[model samples]
Every structure is written in structure tokens, then in C-alpha cells.
Target: MLYWFFTNPVSLSRWADKHAEGRKLFFKCLYLFTAFLGIAVAASGAVESALAWMPRSWVRYDEDGESEWIASSIAHVAGFIVAFFVTLKGAELATRIRRLEEESN
Candidate 1:
């Protein structure tokens, strides 16, 4: 299934060369993003569990709920950042490929 996506010879060749040139930068960014996501999810889950385990005394007004809210907000922000960068990179790569194709025409 994934193989089919990259099997077009022309696209494959172009993509391979482009990827090779950008591989280090791409993987560095990818791994950093992945790590951020992992940390954010884990932190959010931990916050939720902590809130659940809290004593009745800690369940007062919304002020007491701020920590969980902060954790969840961080997770959401990290997700948005990763998605934004991924989309931006994909669009840039697509544009470069299209331009190359047009030039070769």
C-alpha cells in the first residue's frame, strides 16, 4: 500500500533525490516533533491521572483545575505546532516538485 504511493518512476526518482538532500534535516525535525508529541501526551495523561487521584480537598473551584488545563493546553499547542510544520514542509516540497516538472516540460 505505501509502496504503491511511491512507485511512480518519475516521482520516485525526484523524491529520492530531494529526500536524500534533505534527509538529515527532515529526520531531525521529525524526531524532535515526535519527541515533543510523546512528551505532551504523556504529560497530559499524567496530569489527568493526578487530577483523578486528588483528594476531595483539591477539587474546589476552577483555580484548582488550572494544572490539568495547562497540561492539556500544552499538548494541544504541541500538536498544532507539529501539524503546522508538517503541512508547511509538505506544501513546500510539492511546490518544488511541480516547478521542477514544469521546467522539464
Candidate 2:
């Protein structure tokens, strides 16, 4: 997963060429997607932890009633994470489409 975060598609292909002997296309695609997922998870976890450590002014909890601050913060992080990964994956897919088109031409 870290490999994906650190390398672009071309680098990944080269790494596979060097290390993934006899690997099927299915596994390579799986690895790429899973690495993306790992990135998303790491980002989301960081957001959650950052929120948890934010100043009182940034994240205030209700003292008298059922505190919804934690849930709110979590929801915020979750939404950001979903949006981030969706956008990232969409870009990656679009790049793949363009690359395939170029190859076919």
C-alpha cells in the first residue's frame, strides 16, 4: 500500500516488472486499488485524530445534553475521506482511460 502512495503508475509497473514475476493482471489491479484504499484509510485516521486533538474552540461538546460533538467530528472526517478517495479514484480511472486510448491508437 505504501508503495502505491509513493509511486506513480509507471513506477508501479516497473516495480511489478522487476518483482512480480508471473503475476496476473487481476492481482496487479487489486494491489493498486487496495493501495489506494490504504491511502484513504490513513488520511481518514489522521483527520479523526487531528479533530480529537483540536482546540476547544475548534470542537466544542455540549456539556448539558447528549454530546454530539464526537459524532459530528467523525461524520465530517468520514465525508471528507469519502470525497477524497472518490475523487482520487475517478482521476486514476480517467488517466487509465486516456492511457488505454493512446495505446489503442
Candidate 3:
């Protein structure tokens, strides 16, 4: 896993090279990657901000007599879920890139 982690840039470079060298739909794919990354960052940042603010007691709590802020908690988890999908999208992109790299080799 660590090895794979370290080698990601090489794969990314090759993928970018393929795109730069006249592959069609390059901008389309790049736009999707940018959008996904933007969404992932926004979602994760919102979750982090919410969790950080929770300690200040500014979050709303459910009226069921528990101190747990149920709605905010759910939102945090949903934010992470959205971020996780973006990560999965990245993995899928890497796999497709690797396949294309292999095919070209």
C-alpha cells in the first residue's frame, strides 16, 4: 500500500501526458476531476468545521433530552460519505489510467 501511495505521481504524470498528447475529451475529464476534488474538499472542510464548532456548544441538539446534536451529527457523517465517494471516483480514475498506461505499453 505504501509503495502504491508513493508511485501515484508517476501514474498521474503518465496519464496527464497521454491527455496532453492529443487524446480527445481531455478537458471534459479534467473538468470532472476538478469538480470532484472541489466537492470533496468542500464536504470534508464543512464536516471538520462543524465538528470543531461542536465543542463550543453552538450546535443544535435534539429535544429528546439528550445532549447529542443529532442533526449535525448526521450531516457530518453525510459529508464524509460525499467525500468518500469522491475518493472512490479517484480510485476508479487511477485504475482507468493504469489500464490505459498498460495498453499503450
Candidate 4:
């Protein structure tokens, strides 16, 4: 999935030399946001799966037993937080691009 996201032709930027600074910045921000979001979502899914497969007995506080679920849950939550920020940044950049286009017309 990560490979597909990075290599997809549809998301590639192909601005002409006359492209405005605002447009370039918008595309840069949009791409970075998408990449980060994709990574976060993938990481979250992996952590969730690991957490789910962990045995419940491991979480019962046995001596020498580690609670893998706790660590996995933390990772999942962190990914979610980063994903939220990336999404917000992406929306803001997109809106800026739209406004600039409207004004240029």
C-alpha cells in the first residue's frame, strides 16, 4: 500500500513553469500530508492487529510476562493523533489553493 501511494501517477505533481508559488506550496503540502496519513493509517492497522492477536493471559500480570497489548495500543493511539493533524493540515492547504485560484480568475 505504501508503495502504491508513493508511485501512483495520479498524485504526481506536474506543474508548469508558470505555476504560482501558492499552487506549488499547496501541492507540496498536500503530498506530504497524504504520505504521512497513509503511513499512520497503515501503522495503526498493524498495531491493532498485533494487539488483537496477543494472548489475554499475557496481560494478566504474570511474572516475566509482558503486556504487548499495552504497547500496541499506545502506538495505535499515537498514529491516530498524527493522522488527525495531517488531515487538518491537508484540508487547510487545499482550501488555500482553492482561494488562490478563485482570486487569480
Candidate 5:
């Protein structure tokens, strides 16, 4: 697998064609995970922020407003994951299209 990544451009396409379907599925799963985690983290942040704004006298709580950092970190990681998968999948699609065009020609 590492070799596949290190190969030249022509070799890369050959390698990709051999594992096209598997790679596609892998990237799709990665993309989905990123999306899911991002949403979850953002939701948690929103909830935490809401809680922080709530009247402390009515309901005593121990959570600090530091959850914003957690949310921001998650957002950054999720964004990277999302971007990686999007580019990977787009390359896969472009390769598939190019192959099909070549075959038709």
C-alpha cells in the first residue's frame, strides 16, 4: 500500500485501477465519519455554550466554557478529514471517468 502511494503518476493510476472499488469505499467511510464527528462535536459545543449561559443559581454546574476549544479542535480535524476524503474520492471519480473515456476511444 505504501508502495502504491510512492509510485510514479502512471504507476499510481495502475495501482488505483487495481484497488479502485476498495479505495472508493474506504474514502466514503472516512468522509462519513468526518461528517458525523464534526456534527456531533459542533452540537456538543452548542449545548455546552447554552449551558454556560444558563442561570447558575438555579442549576449548579461544573462545566467550564473551555469546551469551545474542544469544539474548535474537532472542527479543524474534521475539516482536514473531510477535505482529504473529498479530494481522494474526487481523484477516484476522475480516474474512473478517464479510464472509461480511454476505453471508449
Candidate 6:
């Protein structure tokens, strides 16, 4: 399996350099995608935080919020896990882009 999440900055730099040019549309699209993922990560985190603080009664489906809590909690955790990798990816891509820019100088 390609453990892209485990790749080092050097590998990321190499990948960026291999992408035809330093500032191609691919890079632009990647940057934009990471930016959006950042927003989603933030939103997911906020939702988790809010849910944590809110009263259990807010869900209002069952007498107890157990089911809703479990579902939302699972979703929140999943969101965080995904966010962790994507955040790393974004940072890696940004570092690679910077490396490419430096190399072109």
C-alpha cells in the first residue's frame, strides 16, 4: 500500500518537482483542495466541540441520547482521523511547493 501519509518532506518535494512544472494547474487544484479540507476539518472539530458541550437532551430522538451520541461521536472521531491525515497532506504539499519554488530560483 502507498503510505502517502507517512512520506517525508523530501519525498513530497520530489513528487512536486515531478509534476511537470512548479506552478501548474495541478498544484493550484491541490492547494485549493487542501484549503477546502482545512475548512471542513475546522467545521467538523467545531461540531464535535459543540456537541460535547451541549446537553444530551438536544438530540431529542430518544429518551436518552445514547444512539445519537454514539453516531455523532463516531462521525466526529472519523472526521478527526481524516482531518489529521489531510492536514498532514496539506502541510506536505505546501512544503513541496515551497521547495519547488526554491529550486527554481
In lDDT terms, which candidate is top? 2
In order of appearance, the predictions have TM-scores of 0.37, 0.41, 0.42, 0.43, 0.37, 0.40
* Model 4, span 1-105: residue lDDT tens: 345335431233334114545576665566666777786988788767766766655443436765445656666797887677866676566457756766899
**Looking at candidate 1, what is the lDDT of residue 5?**
28
TM-score of 2: 0.41
Task: Using TM-score as the measure, name the better of candidate 2 and candidate 3.
Answer: 3
Return whichever of 3 and 5 wins on TM-score: 3
Q: Candidate 5 residues 60-96, lDDT tens each?
A: 2336733243434444565566556655665577567
Q: Tell me which of candidates 4 and 6 scores higher on lDDT.
A: 4
Candidate 6 Cα RMSD after full superposition onto the native fold (Å): 7.8
Model 1 residue runs over 4 Å out of place are 1-69
**Weakest ten-residue segment in model 5 by summed lDDT:** 65-74
Candidate-wise lDDT, in order? 0.53, 0.62, 0.60, 0.60, 0.53, 0.59
lDDT of 2 by residue, 1-105 (tens): 656624555455556667777874654576557656666676667666667655445545576754455644674668567756665785577468657866999
lDDT of model 4, residue 97: 71
How high a TM-score does candidate 3 get?
Answer: 0.42
Specify the poorest-scoring 10-residue window by lDDT in model 2.
5-14
Per-residue lDDT over 1-105 for candidate 3, one digit per residue giving the tens place of the 0 to 100 score:
334323353444455566566753464355446656666668866776666645546555557766765446656667768966875676577668868878999
**Residue 45 lDDT, candidate 4, scale 0-100:** 80
Best by TM-score: 4
Q: Per-residue alpha-carbon lDDT of model 1 for 1-105, expressed as tens digits?
A: 345323333444455466667574554455445545555566556555655544444432365554344444544565566556654665466558868887999
Backbone clashes in model 5, listed as residue pairs: none
Q: Over all chains combined, what TM-score does candidate 5 have? A: 0.37
